[model samples]
Target: MIAPAPGISLGIDIGGTFTDLVLHDPALRRSGSLKILTTHADPVQGILEGTRRLLGEASVEPGEITRVVHATTLFTNALIERKGALTALITTAGFRDILKIGRERRYELFDLMLRPPAPLMPDALRLEVPERVKADGTVVTPLDLAALDAAADQAVAAGAEAIAILFLHSDLHPAHEEQAARRIAARHPGLSVTASHAIVREMREYERGCTASANAYVAPMAGRYLARLGAELAAMGIAGPLLLTLSNGGMTHVEEAIRAPVQLLESGPAAGALAAAYLAGAQEPRILAFDMGGTTAKLSVVEHGEPEVVFGFEAARQARFIEGSGLPIRISTVDLMEIGAGGGSIARRDAIGLLKVGPDSAGSEPGPACYGRGGLEATVTDANLLLGYLDPSRFAGGRLPLDRRAAQAAMARLAAALGITAEAAAWGIHDVVTEAMASAARTHLAERGRDASGFTLVCTGGGGPVHGYHLARKLGIRRVIVPPEAGVASALGLLTAPPRVDRVATLGRRLLAWRAAELEAAFAALEAEARGVLARGGWAEDAPAPERVVDARCVGQGAHMPVTLPPAPWPTDDAALHAMITEAFTAAYQERFRRPPPAVPIDLVHARIVLRGAARPLALPPARRGWEGPATAHQRQILSGGCSAMADIYSRPGLMPGFSARGPALVEESGSTLVIGGKGRFSVLENGNILVELDA
Candidate 1:
C-alpha cells in the first residue's frame, strides 16, 4: 500500500454560494475547515484566498500538504450560463437537426409557450458526416473520412475549441466513431473531441448525443480552471496529488476529470448524500439528505446505506423543478430532486399577492439584501434575519457582517406591498420556503415509497443547519443529525470517497438467449474493460476486480434498471443466470413499486461495471471524550406557545462521549454553528457525530 505523503491534505468544494475548504493532518489527527463567499468573477481567487486563510489559521506551510481533492459546480454553471467555449457538433448525414428535435415532450402540458432547451451547438456549427450503423453493432457504411476532415477544417475556422461527434447507433458499433475521431485528431492536432460511444454507450440517441455534447461544452472551461487551480496550489508550496469528485459519488484523478467534466456536474449534491448515507447508521435506513445552499436546495433519498443511483440527469432547466425542460446528460448521478428554495432565494409577491419563494437567487456577487452587498431584493436570508432566526452579527463567522437595516428595509417593502408587518412578512416567507422544501421532500420520498418518519435528517451546506430544524418540524421528523462541520459537509465527503470508474455499454440481448455460455463471455469482456480503465487511472495490476453490473428489463419494457452481479465466473448456467437476473430485477422493482413483478420473459439492455479501489478508511474524530467542559449557565428562550425558559450553550469540542446537552442550546464550531431550539436534545455519538433530536 502506498502511504499518503506526510502532509496535510486539502479538500475544496466550490458551491454556488460558498467555497468550502478542509485541511486535515492524518499523522496529527487534526483538521480545520473554512467557508468563503465564492468569487464568481474568478473562482480561482476564492480558492487561493481560502487556502491561504486556512493554512494561516493552522500555522502550516503549504509545502506540508500531500494531496488535494476538489469538487465544483463550475461546469454546470457554464452550461447554465452558456459561457463555455464556442463549440461545434458533427453528426451522421441527415441528422443535423437531432439536437433540435429532442424527444418532443412538454413537461408542463398546460403552458402556452414551452421552450425545450436550446442545443449547445448552433445550427451553423452542426455539420453532418456520411456514415451509417445498424442497431446491432454493424456498420452499414464506412465513415466518410474526407467529409469528416472537411468538417474539422470548418469547425476550426469557425473557432470551435471543442467538437462533439454523435452518430446514429454508435453505441452499438463505435468503430466508425473511433476511426473518425482518430483521423480528426491527427488532422486538427488541437481540437478536443468527444464521441458518444466513448463517454456514454447507452442506446438512446438523443441522450447519448446530449451527454457527449455537454461534455464538450465544458471541456475547455474545466481544463483551464483545473490547471490554474493546481498551479496556484503548487506555487504556494503544496505538493499533493489533486483528485476531483464525480457525480457518481466517487473521486477520480484530476487529469481524468478535466477530460470528462460532465461526470462531475452533480458532484456537490452527491457528496452531501454520501455524507448522509455514511453517517445515518440506521438498519435499512431511509434518509432525506437536505443540502441547502445559496442558489438551490437539493433533496436526495438514501436507502440501505447508499444513495439511489440515476443513469441520466437534466440541467439548466427553464423551470427549476421541471424534468424535461433542460439539457439531458447521460452520467451516473445520485438521484436528487432539486428546487430553487435557498437562503439567497429572492422572495416576492406574485401577480395575485401570493407569496413566492424562488426560481431566482442573489448569488455571491450581490448577495441577499441583509448582506449589504448591493442587493435590494428581499431574500430568504433577509427574511430569516428579520424573523430572529439568524444572528446578524455572527453571520459567516463574522467574516461578512449582516446589516439589519438593509434586511429591515427589504422586508418592510414586502410587508407594505402585502399589507402586513415586516416581522409577519418575514415569517410568511420563511414558512413558505420551509413548506416548499418539505413538500418537495415529501413528494420525492412518496414517489420512491419512502416515509419521512423512517429516516433521519442529515442537513448540511450553508443554509442546511439553519433551516433543518424547521424543515424537520414541518415533515414531522423527530431526529436530525447535524455533523460537526455541517457547512462544509460536501468537501469533507470528498476525503472519504474511493477512486472509482463507471463504464457502460449496450448489449441489447435477450435473457432467453440461445446460449448461457455466450452471456458469460459478454460479462467477462465487460469486466475486463472496466479493469483496464481502473488500471489506466493508476490502480495497481493486482487491485480487486470491479463490480459487474447490467441494465435489465422485461422484453417489451422501454426502460430498465441497473443490477449488480457477483464478481466473475458469473452464473454461467442457464437456470442460475435466470435466477440471478430475477433476484436483481425483483429487488429493484420491489423497492420502487413495493411489490415484485409477475414472472415474465426478461431481456438484458446494457452491461456495466464499476471498478473501485479500496477506500482509505477515515479517522473519525473521537467522540467528545467523556464530557466535562466549563460549567454551563442556563439561558432562557420562549417555548412553542409558552413562556420563556432556560437552555445551555455548550462547547462541542469540550463534550465527550456519553455526554448530552439539552434544548434551546447553541453548539458552536469553528466552521459552523448549530442551534438547538427549545425542547431539543443533543448527543455526541461514538463516531463524533452530533445527533440533535427535536420535538415534533
Candidate 2:
C-alpha cells in the first residue's frame, strides 16, 4: 500500500501514441506510473481518464497532487498539421518580403526542382510599418504611430487572431519595437502579439523573424488550451500550480509558457533524454538514450550525467534530416535525433519492390491492427503481436487487449503483396524498423564524433526495451540498461527537472577594447530580465545565480563559438577579468579548431545566461533491496532466427535484485517487457533496472 504523504508530484508526457503519467511522493520515496492510449481528437481527455484511473489505483486523492508538470508533442503536431490560429506578420517598412527573401543558399545543393519552404503567414497578411533602427543600436527613422495603426488595422481586418512584429536591428535596439508593441496592445486588446526581439535577441534577421512568427502562429492556440486546462484541473480539485516543460528540459508555470509556446517544441524528447541521464548515473558516464514511442524514436547522447545541449535546432523540416530545410528556431534545446522507428510505424512495399518501414505512423485513433480500433494496416505493433513478443491477454495490463487473429490477418495481407508467408512478413517488419533505427543511429553518432561501441544503451518508452537488445547489437554496443517503469520514464523526468529560464542579448562589441564595466552592465540588465521571468514562474527568490556565456568569434568569421564564464562574482579588477575571458575563448577555439589563436581581434556577438532552480531529489536507489521476490519463469513461443523458439519468460516485478538468467528470455511487466536474444545474459540489477550483457 502507498502511504499518504505531504503531497505528490505528478508528471505527464503526451506522445504520438501513448500518454504516460507518473505520480511521485517525495516523502515516501515511492512512485506510481500508468500508460494509456492517446486520444487523438482531444488529448486532454486521455489525460483525464489516465489521471483518474492512476490516482484511484494508487489510492491517492486529487488534492494530494501538489505539483504538476506536463510535456507533450502537441505544439510540434500543431506546426506540422498547420492547426494554429490565423496569424499575420508585421515588419519595418520595405521589409514585408523579408520572410520570403530568406537565405540564398539552398538546403539541397543540386536538387533542380527544390524550392524553399513557404513563410508561415500569407503574403497578403504580411504588413509593414514605418520604422528603422541602425545595426549598432541607433535610431534612423523613428516609429510612425500612424503607419503602425494602419498595419494593425490590416492584420485585424484580415481575421488574424495573432500577429508577429519584426523590426530590423531590433536585437540591438528594441525601443521602436517596444513602442510599437504598446500601441498595438492598446488598440487591439484581444490579439496575441509576438515581438521579434522578445523571442530571439540575435543578429540574424530572417531567423529571428521566423522564430517570432512561429511563436505567434501557435500562441493563441496554446493560450486557449492552457487556460482551459488550468481551469479544468482546478475544477478537478487539484489546486497545485500547473507547470509546462520547456525544450531545454526545465519547468515553467503556465503563464510563462503561454507567452512563448515555441520554447515547448520537442519538449517530450528532451524529457526522455533527462530520464536517460538520470538512470545512467555516474557509473555509466557515456550512454545512448533511445526512447521509442508509438510515432517515432528519439535518440540522444548523455555524458557525465548531462545530455548534450545545442544553441538551436530545426523543426518540421521539409527534408527530415537536412538542417536548413526547416524553420530556424533559435532556442536552447537538448540535442536529440529522431528516427521513424516506432511500434505504430506502418510497413509497406515501395514502388521499387523493396520493403520500407515508416516515416508515417498509425496513431492511437486507429492504432495497430492488433489494437482492434478499426485499423487494417500491418504495423510494427501488429508484427510484434504476431511474433509472440507481446502478450495478447495482458497488453497494457489488460486495459487494451491485443487481437491476435486480426494481427495475423493483417500480416497475411502484407505478405501477399511481397510474395511471402505471414510469419516471414512479421519478422520482416520487426527487422526493417530495427535496421532503420540502427542506420539513423550510425549517422547521428558519426556526426557527433562518437563511437557506438564505447557507449552503453539506455532504453525508455514503450517500444525501446522490447527492441533495444537487437538495436544495441546492431550498433556494436555490449550493454543495455532498461530502467524500472521504462515506458513512463519521460513523465518521471518532468518530476525531477528543475525550473530554468534562458536569456540572451547581442553584444556587438570587440572584446579587446570592451571594458569590464560595460560588459557587466549589459549582462546585469539581461540577468534582471531573466530573474523577472523566474519571478513570474514563482522561482526567482530561491533560484541560484545564472550561468554566463559569450558567443565569441574572430573578426572575419561569420559564426561564433559559445564560451562559458568561469564562475559567479567575477574578478573586481578589469584587466584580470579581461584576461580570464580572453584565455577561455582561446582555449575553446584551440580545442575546436586545433590551431593557435588568430591574429585578428575577437568579436563578442551575443551573451547568454541560464538561471535555474534546484532539481527535485528523486534518484532511484542502487537496488530494490529487501523487496525482492521469486523469479519464477514460464515458457512461451517467440520468434527467433526466422523460426519459433520456446523462451523462458519471467515476471519482472516478481524478480528479485541479483536474479540472473540466460538469453532467450522475456521479462514481463505491467506495461512493457524486455525481449532478450539468445546471445546474451540478462539480470535484474540493484535499482530494479534490467541489465543485458551481450556476448562478445
Worst 10 residues of 1 by lDDT: 634-643
Give lDDT tens digits, candidate 2, residues 455-517. 999999889888999899899999999988888889998877888888899988888677878
326-431 per-residue lDDT for model 1 (tens digits): 9888898889988888888998889998888886889887999988889998998897666554656666766878898999999899888888888777878877
Each prediction's RMSD over C-alphas, in Å, is 2.7, 2.7
Evaluate residue 381 in candidate 1 and report its C-alpha lDDT on the 0 to 100 scale: 86
Q: What is the TM-score (0 to 1) of candidate 2?
A: 0.96
Model 2, position 660: C-alpha lDDT score: 88
Q: Where does model 1 exceed 4 Å of error?
A: 1-7, 282-284, 541-543, 595-599, 623-651, 654-662
